[model samples]
Target: MSKFAKAGVAKKVMDEARKPQNQQKIKSAISNFTNKNKGGGTGAKPR
Candidate 1:
């Protein structure tokens, strides 16, 4: 797995990895983990 700190899409990658239903969607995690951006961390969204 890619380093969460290095990747800009930590939340997107981790959130996808944490779900059980995403077992067959491992590629999604890779995609998110590799995504590049200049934005800051994506903290939990307010309810």
Candidate 2:
């Protein structure tokens, strides 16, 4: 209920929401794996 506690909580939440440096690399790896192994895009394949 105090201002200090509220500020600390808000700062923690904001920090968590900020993307880390490795996020893009991780995302790209996942995307590449899915594409190579499972046809990653959103399209219907001919049977």
Best by lDDT: 2
Runs off by more than 4 Å, candidate 2: 20-47
State residue 10's C-alpha deviation in candidate 1, in Å.
1.3
lDDT of 2: 0.77
Whole-model lDDT per candidate: 0.69, 0.77
- State the lDDT at 11 in candidate 2: 92
TM-score of each: 0.30, 0.40
lDDT of 2 by residue, 1-47 (tens): 99999999999866765667556666788899877777556567768
Candidate 1 achieves a global lDDT of 0.69
